[model samples]
Structure formats: structure tokens, C-alpha cells
Target chain A: MNIRPLGDRVVIKKLEAQEKTKSGIVLPTQAKEQPQMAEVVAVGPGGLVEGKEVKMEVEVGNKVIFAKYAGTEVKYDGIEYTILKQNDILAIVE
Target chain B: MNIRPLGDRVVIKKLEAQEKTKSGIVLPTQAKEQPQMAEVVAVGPGGLVEGKEVKMEVEVGNKVIFAKYAGTEVKYDGIEYTILKQNDILAIVE
Candidate 1:
């Protein structure tokens, strides 16, 4: 199933959070940092907002970083995804 | 003192929460919805992100709605402000 985003929103597939620390000790779910990396799956049309034109920056295949706890999380077809505005995207990963 | 947002970041002054509901019954702080309306005080320069030019949509002095729990709160110079990226803003109100 497709989760088409509206406006400047985009659908992203989150990267798995690290289960362990750098020291190789396993950490509990609540103790680990929330996952921030994601792969952009779909992008919505970004246009004029408040008399200013807002442009879309990331492409569908780009890997990006999102603000922690930014958007609604949903599970679709057994895959977890997040729908967020493009502004929630912090950075693009090469 | 100035809170100059950097890299598409913005400084906003949150609007006061309504103490009473539409039904005219006064509500306590915990019973009210989180305050989301904000006035844009300062805006960061919208620039290239991930090799694409990301233009800013809202201008200074515009009233906007932000996602719940989207920014870092601070009390500066006797006033409260929230520092968040442009994406955290949900809409601009006329």
C-alpha cells in the first residue's frame, strides 16, 4: 500500500535503531536514542506558503535525518513508516 | 538580546493558552490543549539543503501553528520563545 503524503509532507522508512552502545553492551529500548535516519519513499508537492514559495529539497531515494519525535508513525504492509513535513528533515545523508 | 535562528531555524513567541473553553467553562492548565499558535520573531536564512534551494515560506511577524512539542523552549529577557526548524510549523494563520 502507498502512503502518499500531502503538501510538503513526505513518507519515510525509518532505519533500525542501534540495539547496542559503542562499547557493545546491549541497551533497552527506552534507553536507546530514538532512530532518526530514514529513507525517503515519497515526496509531496511543495508550493506557496504564506505568500512565499517553499521548495522541495529531498528526492524519493535520498536518505535523510529527521528530528526525533517529529511525526506520526504508522505500520503499513508490515513496514513501519513516518509521515512528516519536509521541514522535519534535519539533514541529508550521503 | 537576540535569538537569531540559524539555517532555516526560527524563533517564535508562543501565544497564551486559552483559559476557557468555547462553552464558557474555565479550564485548568493541564486540561487545556497545548499552545500551538506562535508569532514569528526571527527567521533564519533559507538556503541550500542537500544541494537544493529550500526557500522559507513564512516571514517575520506572521502567525503560525506548530506541531505539538516541536521545539526547545527558553525564557529569554523575560519573554518565552521556542527555537525550531521551519518544518515544525504546521500552518500560517491570516
Candidate 2:
């Protein structure tokens, strides 16, 4: 299934978090939380500011760090996706 | 208490959620979660994009609606605050 964001919102696919510690210790499911890292897959054209269109700074394929609890979660094609506004993005990893 | 945001981060104080319905019906505590509304109190000077500084679009006193789960929670002077990037802000209430 294809999903498109509305306005300045972006669709992201989260990166899986490590299940084991660096010391090779495995963590239980209840002990781990959803990951905060994601890859930008789709983005809105831009948002309106005072009736003028403002383009987004981040683009598709950017790896971003977002807040753990941000965005609305949705499932498409058996994959989990997140829809978040551009402002919800914190930083783009180089 | 005084708090300063780092980089393009902004600090917001959450608006209280209505405990009772408009019809005067009250919801139970377990049914209620933290409010998603907030007012911008402090903002970072700006963030660097491609070596250029960009100013924030929203200003202090702007009431905004953020995602149900966004921002890092912090406490200062016995008050709770959320620290989020400028992009996390969805819209400014007029």
C-alpha cells in the first residue's frame, strides 16, 4: 500500500532497535521500547505560511532522529509507518 | 523557573486537559492522558542548515498542538516542560 503525507507531514519507516546489549546480553521484549530512529520515505510538498508555500528542508532518504513518542502510528502493507510533521523531526544524521 | 532551549529546540508548557466533557460529564483518570496542547515559552536562537542560520517561524505565546507523543519531558521549578525541535510544532492556534 502507498501512503502520502498531508501538508508538511512526512512518512517514516522506523529502524529496528538492537535487541541485545553491546556486551552480548539479550533484552526481553517488555524491557525494550520502540526505536526513535527512522528513515524518511515520503514527504508533503510544503506547508502554507501566511498564504505562501514554504518548502521542507529534509527530503526522502534522510536518516533522522525523532522523539520516541512523536507521530501517529499506522500500518501499511504489513509495515509500520509513522506520520509526523516536519517540525517533529529533530536532526538529520550525516 | 527559567529554562533555555538548545539549538532550535523550544520549551513549552502543556495546557491542562479538560477533565469533564462539554456536557459536564467527567472522564476517569485512566481514560485521560497528558494533553497535547502547549504554549511556547522559550526557543533556541536558530539551527544551522548547510551552514546558514534559520529563524523559527513560531514565537513565544503561540499556542500549538503537538503530537500525542513528542518531545522530551523535563521538570523545572516543580513545573513540567517539553523540549522539542521547531519542526515538531504542527500548527499555531490563531
Candidate 3:
């Protein structure tokens, strides 16, 4: 029931796109853009990847901004998640 | 001027697509398919990239097969080449 990414990969749950305006007006579904923000669900055990030594920097529950159009989309238990390599992540959000 | 790729990257010159038939007939330009094979032109210094320790594996003059649509196409001194990360190279042709 859980996904364990392998070798420098990470499993992330995308933060829901903001659908409400600053004035609390709800925007339509078509107006909601896919957010690049996500919470790290799992971190891969970093070791030898493509002959390189990789060390995982991000930890579980950390918010991050990832590259657009990167990673694979997967559905588990009716929940959508993205699995991507650590390099695809641009920055960790505080 | 020659291009020198940066860290963990490689510059490769794509091999010319076969333009002749086995029967010694010359095929039209439109019939030529892009070849995936290339000769390594320059290799980046092996070092820290994306927080990982990457070691350069391929060397200059080595023929390698790279992933399709990988790397950035660049023209230098009237010649075309591709600059891509080392991971984008799939295998070295013996």
C-alpha cells in the first residue's frame, strides 16, 4: 500500500492547487493551474546511481518545488502521486 | 572554437546517418534517419553535480549510444554537436 522509490528517486504528493482567491472567492476548476509544490512522501536510499554516488538531501514531509513536466504520475489507493528523481527537484521550501 | 562541456556533461558529434543501400544505391536525403550513435568529443571533469559525486566514464573518441531527444543541440565552428549529461548516454559501443 506504500511506494518505496529506488535509487535517488522520491515519491511526492502534490499540494492541491489553490482554488480560492485572496478575497475567498472560489475559482473554477479550469482556472486552477497545476502547482509545482509538493510534500516529500518517501526518500530513496541514495547510493550508486548511473555510476555516481548520490546522497539524498530531502527528507520526508519537506515541501519542495520540482521541475515542471518531470517525473511519472502514479495513482495509489485513489490518491495521485508523482515519482521523480531527486535531481528534478529544484529547491526545498521552508 | 571547440566546446568544452561543464561538469558531468559530454559533447558528442553525431554520426552521419547511413545514406546508401547495401546494393550500393544512394538513398535520398529524406530517407535518412537520425542516428543515435555519436563520438565523444569532450568530457566534463568528474566532480560534484547536483550534490552528487559523478565520475566521467566515457572518453573522447569513444562511440556511444545516447537516449533519443536527450541533450542540447549546438553548432560550433560549422559543426553540430550535442551536449548532454553523462547519464543520458546509454552505452559505449565496443
Candidate 4:
């Protein structure tokens, strides 16, 4: 991974969706929603916006939760990833 | 109008959707998608997360573009607004 996102953007590896319930019942493909959790892979250096300098909050390897339907999906080497701005991240998962 | 969002959260007033299309065609109600543009009303101070302090890039009154279906909707004083984290904002419209 030799890529850096431009200004306020982030690169993330989306976590795989769960396929089973609490009772261990396998769910159908349509029964699960798109995964909203991911691992931060790379981050962009914050830049100027309206004369204010921004800073990044997340770091590489942080597990994060992001907005559903946010970010663009990018496929590299047959692995899927997402790229979005830092603002789309809701929280860092512990 | 006295709402202050907590930590990395933002308050935005959604821009109304256009009712007509190009060439003077009137779009029906069901044909319009939810608005993804907004005016920033308030911003939260970036906070400590994983030993890093995030910084806010956007200010009040900025026209911003965000992901559709990203934020939580709220109605106050008969006006609709959205509350989302900074990561949900894609760009600031100049």
C-alpha cells in the first residue's frame, strides 16, 4: 500500500459482513446490511479550508465505524477498500 | 437554535431539493432523492482520540456536500436539520 489520500481523505479496509446471528443461524445474503466497520489503512494530511488548518484524528490500524453508504469503493489486487473523507468516520472501535 | 453538537459532530441545515429538471420538466415528488448539500450551522470542538487531537476544518455558514443518508434527521421549530460527524462531510462548496 503505497498510497496517501489527498487532504482529509482516508483509506480503509472494510470489515467482512457477519453471516450469522447470535444463535448461530446462517443469514441469507440479503438479510445483512453493508458493513460499516473498517480498519484505517492510510490517512491524508489535513489541509487548508477557509483559512483554517485541519488535523487528522484516526491513524493506521485503528478500527473505525463509518457512515453507511459513505465513501467510494476501490478495488485493488482483487481486495476491496473504501476511500472517504475524515468527516465520515463516526467513531473508533475499541 | 442553541444546540451545540458534541465532539466532532456538526449541525447542518439541508438545502432543499430542486423541483424541476433541465428543459423545464417538472419532477415529481417520488423522483427526487434526499438532499446531500447543507449549510453548516454549528461545529463541535475536535477532541482527544487515541492520543491525537482532531481539528475542525469547517466553520459556521459553510455550504457543504455530504453523503446521502449519512446523518440523523431532526426537526426543530418546523425546520429540518441534520446531525452528523465531521467524517460525513465530503466537501465545502465555495
Candidate 5:
């Protein structure tokens, strides 16, 4: 399913978390935390401030690091999508 | 301890979660989720685009809503702080 964000929001598809620990120990799903990495899919045109349009810095296909607990989670066609503001993005991976 | 972020990062202090549920039942800490509300304590001087300096849109003391899982967690002087990029912020409360 296609999803689009309104305003300065963006839609991200989270990367899957590692199933094994650094020590090579396997962890159960309940023991695993949400992944903090995501790929930018769709982004809003930009944010508005004082009736002026502010353009976005990040673009589609950028791999970004974000907070573990940021964004609203939604399920569409059995796929999960995150809606986050532009500022929530921590860094863009080159 | 005072903490300031470098670059386009911002420091946020998470608001305390409600101790009681809407039904007035007390929930255990394990069952409680992290609070999504925060106050912006500091912000970076905008982000660099192609080596050009950009100014920030938000300022200190802005009550902002961010993604539930964005930012890096740090502890200093027995207090917790989150370092997030300017884009991670969803909205500023007026």
C-alpha cells in the first residue's frame, strides 16, 4: 500500500533489527527492541513557518538514523510505516 | 550537569509519564511506556548544506512533539538527556 505524509512529515520503513546479539546469542522477538534505522520513502514538500515554505534537506532513499521511540506507527497492507517529523532524523548515512 | 549538543543536534528532557491510567489504575513501570513529550533545551545552529550554514527553526524552551523512538540517550550528572537532530521534531506547541 502507498502511504504519504502531510506537511513536514515523512514516511519511513524501518530496517529489521538484528536477530543475534554481538556475542552471537540469539534473542527472542519479545526481547528485541525496535530498530532505529530506516529508509526514507516519502517526504512532505517542506514545513511552513510564518506563512513561508521551508524546503526539506533530506530526500527520498536516504538511510537515516532516528530515535528508537520516535514517530507514530501505522500498519498498512500488513506493512508498518513510521510518520516522523523532519527534525526527528538524527543523521543521514552516506 | 549542563549538556550542549554539537552541530544540528538538540537536547531534550523527556516529560514524566502519568503514574495513573485514565481509568485511575496505577500501572507498573514495566508496563508504562516512555513519555513522548519533551521540552527543547538547546538546538544546533541549523544544519550544513553543501558547507553553507543554515539557521535553526526552533529555539530553546520550545515544547515539541517528536517521534516516540528518536535520538540518542545520554546520562550526565544523574540526569538523562536526548540528542536529536532538528528534523526529528514533529511539532512545536504554541
Candidate 6:
């Protein structure tokens, strides 16, 4: 990707929603909601945001869990992605 | 009135929705949505919030405009109020 996010924003690729449950029951796509987990694709520089100094916490390629309905969806080169503030990310998934 | 907000949170009383439009037409209360304007009832002492330095901007009795659906609604002593971060406030009305 040739794009770089600015100031506390992060670019992420959403992980695919689970298709099967623990009991091995396959679920229809509509039955599942958008996944909360994602892989960090790009990281913005840690700096001031809205008069507040924000330090970027997550790194590129890290798996993360983010708040629901927190990011803007975008499609680039047919690949869907999300752009959200660092604050919207709740935790890094091991 | 005994509540004191912490961090950058502010306590506010929502203004009543307009009963009539400028065209001299009276509208039912149900036809109007929650008002975006509010009177500042109490202000939090701003310092550091979520690892960021925040400065208190609004004062008590200041009429301000805030983002729609931004605050938590609370009922205290039969008076309704909203508690939200100062960042949710859009502008101070004259």
C-alpha cells in the first residue's frame, strides 16, 4: 500500500468472522456479525491529536481487538480495510 | 447538584426542545428531537485524561452546543442532566 495514515490513526484489515462454532456447527454468513479482531496493516506516528499528545501503542502486523462501530470502512484495490483512531483499539490479541 | 464530575467530564442540563418554529407554527413535543444545546451545570477539573493533557474550557452556566447523543443521561433530585466529556461539546453559545 502506498498510503500512510496520520496522527494516531491506524489502518487495519478485519479478520474473517467465524464460520463454525466450537461444536463444529457451520453458521450462515448473515448469522454472524462483523469480527472485532483485525490485523494492523499500518501504524500512524505517535503525536498530538486534537490538542492531546497520543502515543501509538499497537504495531504493524499485530492482531488487535477494537471497539465495535469505531472505524471507517474503506476499499482500496478491491481490498476492504478500516481506519480508526488508536483509542478505538481496545487491546492487542496475542 | 452534589455530583462532581471527574477528569474532563462535565455535567449539563439539556435545553428544552423548541415548542415553535420561526414561522409561527407550534409543533408537538414529540415532533422535536432532543435539543443539542445545554447549560453547563458543573465542570470537571481537567488535567490528564487517558494519558493526555486536557484543559477545562467551559464554565458553569455557559450555554453550549454539543454533539447529538453524546452524553449519559441522568436524573438527580428530579432534575435531568447529562454527563459527558468536554470533547463531546461542540461550541459555546453566546
Pairs clashing in candidate 3? none
Off by over 4 Å in 1: A1-45, A48-94, B19-35, B50-52
**Model 3 misplacement above 4 A:** A19-35, B1-47, B50-94
TM-score of each: 0.45, 0.45, 0.45, 0.46, 0.46, 0.45
| Clashes per candidate, residues 3 or more apart or on different chains | 1, 6, 0, 6, 21, 0
Q: Tens-digit lDDT track for model 5 on A1-94? A: 3677777677888766442222122213331332265778898876563454555766788866565567899887888889987667765544
lDDT of candidate 2 at residue B18, scale 0 to 100: 61
Top-TM-score structure, candidate number = 4
User: Candidate 6, which segments miss by more than 4 Å at Cα?
Assistant: A1-94, B18-35
Locate the minimum summed-lDDT window of 10 residues in model 6 chain A.
A19-28
Q: Provide all candidates' interface root-mean-square deviations.
A: 12.4, 11.5, 15.3, 12.5, 10.6, 14.8
Score candidate 6 by DockQ: 0.03
Q: In model 2, what is the error at residue A65, expressed in angstroms? A: 0.9
List, residue by residue over B1-94, the lDDT tens digit for candidate 6.
7889999899999776451222122222231232266789999997878878777767998866555578899999999999999877644544
- State the lDDT at B64 in candidate 1: 62
lDDT by residue (tens digit), candidate 1, B1-94: 3778877778998765451222122212341223256788998887865555556777888866565578899999889899998877755544
**Residue A84, model 6, lDDT:** 78
Question: Under CAPRI classification, how is model 6 graded?
Answer: incorrect
lDDT, residue A70, model 6: 72
Q: Clashing pairs in model 1?
A: A87-B87
**For residues A26-60, could you state the per-residue lDDT of candidate 6 as single tens digits?**
33445334337778988867565556678998999
lDDT of 4 by residue, A1-94 (tens): 6444546788898776562232243324452443367889888777643234668999999978787577765444456666687889988866
Which pairs of residues collide in model 6? none
Candidate 2: TM-score? 0.45
TM-score of 1: 0.45
Off by over 4 Å in 4: A1-7, A10-94, B19-35, B49-52
- In what order do the candidates fall by lDDT, top score first? 3, 6, 4, 1, 2, 5
Cα RMSD (angstroms) for every candidate in the order listed: 11.6, 11.6, 12.4, 11.5, 11.8, 12.1
